[model samples]
Target: MPYVNIKITNENVTNEQKKALIKGTTQLLVDVLDKNPATTFVVIDEVNTDNWGIGYQTVTEIRQDQ
Candidate 1:
């Protein structure tokens, strides 16, 4: 059994989006790596935009610039 953990932080990510991401990523890993879905666990951790930083800038701040 292989365990996988995934962390993603995005201001636009909703609960549904997180669920889809976990499911999709897990499926991909299982299909590509031939792992068992039942034994494979995927964890998605959502972080606040203020806590996430990119190049010394907050994700929220960066998105604002974009």
Candidate 2:
């Protein structure tokens, strides 16, 4: 089994986009690793802006500065 974890900010992401991510991730494992789609797992973690940070600044703060 192959596990893939994808993390994104808690921005407004559509369901269709999420589905595409899952499908694409699965396909990538199938094509590169020869993993079975049935046994592959793809998880998306949507983190709150306050909980995610970059360059020592929270995403919320970065966006606010922008």
Candidate 1 lDDT: 0.80
Off by over 4 Å in 2: none
**What lDDT does each candidate get?**
0.80, 0.96
Write model 1 residue lDDT over 1-66, tens digit each, in one string: 776676667557788887887789778878899888888787777788889888999988988899
TM-score list, all predictions: 0.73, 0.95
> What tens-digit string does per-residue lDDT give for candidate 2 at 8-65?
9989999999999999999999999899999999999999999998999999999999
**Candidate 2: Cα lDDT at 23:** 99
> Model 1, residue 46: what's the lDDT?
72
Instruction: Kindly provide the TM-score of model 2 when superposed on the true structure, using C-alpha atoms.
Output: 0.95
